[model samples]
Target: MSENVAPTASAPRSLHGWSTEFRATFTLAWPLVIAQVAQNALQASDVIMMGWLGPEALAAGALASSFLMPFFLFAAGVVGAVAPLTAQARGARDIKAIRRIVRQGFWAAILLAALLLPVVLQIRTVFSWIGQDPALAARAEEYIQIAVLMLFPALGVIVLRSFLSSFEATRVILVVTIGGVVVNAFGNYLLMFGNFGMPRLELRGAGIVIVLTNIFMLAAMLAYVLRHRRFRRFNVLIRFWKPDWPRFRELFHIGVPMGLTVLAEVGLFTAATMLMGRLGTDEVAAHAIALQCASLAFMVPLGLGVAATVRVGIAYGRQDREGVRKAGWTSFALGTGFMAVSALCFLLFGPAIVTIFLDPGVPENRHALALAASFLAIAGIFQLVDGAQVVAAHSLRGLSDTKIPMLMAIFGYWLVGLPIAYVMGFVFDWRGVGIWTGLACGLAFVAVLLVGRFAMRERLGLLDRIRL
Candidate 1:
């Protein structure tokens, strides 16, 4: 087996000069941003298609998807540990090390998916335990059960994509995602509407489409990686066919806490979605639309955050502390600015955005629209902070300081954010806006702390402290 070697280190400097690092950052970040956007679009399509099936279907899909979302978060975080490692290796031009990391990451993702199976299998029971209208609960359970089958493929895709991403090979993800979205949409149309002699499965049909789409995406990514000359010659394709226990252990060391960190953050939103179910289907439906809108808007910052991770990772790999610091702050500034524009758009046309997924004429629909609009309005208020915190987290991850951000997510979301949301939304009956207001507070806290952490680390020359 060919070993992956690390890239050679380059001297670090400020961004003042016409630097290779600045050019490299942009070169890598743009394609990554595009790929992230495509993936988000695919996810958004799931919500949109289900929404077209009616409010009940929308509510069921939202509940089911959100319930399963934390698992994906965990999986993504685990896979994400590969990127920084790969990026550092790439910076040092260690093709052998990169190949080894990719192989190990693949196996780690498979194991992580397996470990999550039992938890996913319990999703139905967990939802019931949370207490819901029996009918909606049943629909949610059915959708979730089928969706569970997708865990393997979905996790595989994350691992493969992250590894490839570190090499600045992002176009593969974009191609696969675009194709997957098309497949998902077509399948959803056929399965949901009983088109072209297909059996109509309603909510279950939507889940089936999602599963198939994920499988297709996994296959596509694998094919691309195997066929690509860069990866093929580097021996990543052949190496991935074998197991590497030690490398897997290293991946787990980085991945597990990263998973836990993501779980803590995403789990909060999952909990919020469950809480919405208790407020009636209208509330749940409204929340789903608002969530979708917010999620779509979030793609901008999310893409930037992903880009920031690569930038920071590359800089860290070269041991350029100054470059790492600048990359992070630059991405944060860019993300914040982008989200500010989105927030303004959402504020001025919040109702119109909700209308994309719902009709406002029907009585119940009107109520859903009103609630969703309220939620979006509040969500818009914190878009900038939300972007900042996510970018900050990714930047820190690039620095390989995953633990602190994990703890911060726990404190900010659970101790501070959720309680406030509960008081304002449920206790005080401030409704959707109150819930979002709490989310904003939590996000703001995360933003401040993460950025502060990065600043402190830079000032203390912490990058040198962690260099391998």
Candidate 2:
């Protein structure tokens, strides 16, 4: 392991009125934001297209997505470990370490994909237990089954994407993700409604579109990585081989807990959707719209989090403790500010926003819209905290302190968040707003705890341990 590097022996510089460090951080963050936006657009398009199939189809898509999201938690968290490790390697100028981290990430991705297969196969049973409508459950199960089969290729894409992100080569993600979005939209149009002589598979067709687009994205990303001279020089894509047990262990040490943390958080929302179903079809549809909106709004902060991981990892590698601190704070400030503006928009014009996904002319839809707007209003208050937590968690990941954050998220979301939501949504009959309020509380706790952890780590000179 490369550790203990001296900082550059030079004076700090300024960029316009901003510090050079801040400017560099922003430079890294923008591509990530754009990439995230494009990805969100693809997902939103899916929801929008399915909405045209009527409320039941839309609800089925939501159910399918919620069921499948936890699988991504595993893929995402495992692949996510690569960035910090690679960033540290890059900071140390250790090409060998970088290669090792990248290879190990690929191994983890494959293992995770294999592990998820059984779970995906059991998705039908899981949905039944969650109390989905029999008809909706069948549709959701079909979509999820096909989508799950695509996880193998998707895992490869995520690993490669993580490697590029660690090097701050975020533009690669932007290009491929935007391309995927365009492809997904066209595929959805042709398949979902059977346009241009295509068979109309409806919900199942949408799922197929998602799977095909993901495969195309993986191919595009791999082609770019293989053909690009700069990437070729990194030697990340040599011969494929078996897992290196030691390296795999190290990755698993960090990844499994991180994956569980993500699962816990995502699972809470998935469970919320299940709970919403018990209330009625309209309620579930409304919740789906709200969930989609929240997920879209979250992309800004999510991008910032990815950027923070790279910045912090590089700073840690350089043993620049202060630089790590600055990067984390800058990311938090940028992410929170951007999301806050979005929150205000959601609060002030939530009805209009809901109209984008639901038809107000339908009585059921009108009720759903009202409930969705209410949920959005509560969710708005927590957006800043949500952004803060994600960025802070990413910063900590850069420092290789993934475990504590994982514990915090699990306890905060499950022990605190879910129970509160359950009481409010079910026991107290506070309905949707109650569940959202519970979510806010969970997110708030996570934000406070993560920020505190980051600050403590910085104060203790944790970043100095890694040498670049």
Scored by CA lDDT, what does every candidate get? 0.79, 0.81
After the best TM-score superposition of candidate 1, give how far the Cα of residue 391 lies from its true spot, in angstroms.
Answer: 0.3
Best by lDDT: 2
Clashing residue pairs in all predictions, respectively, total: 15, 4
Regions more than 4 Å wrong, model 1: 1-27, 47-63, 127-146, 189-208, 239-243, 274-286, 355-371, 426-429, 459-461, 465-468
lDDT of 2 by residue, 74-162 (tens): 77787778888888778768887777778888877777889888888787788788676889888888788777867777878888888
Of the candidates shown, which would achieve the greatest TM-score relative to the real structure?
2
Predictions: Cα RMSD each: 5.2, 4.0
TM-score (C-alpha, index-matched) for candidate 2 = 0.87
For model 1, residues 169-210, the per-residue Cα lDDT tens digits are 777777888898899989989998899999999888888888
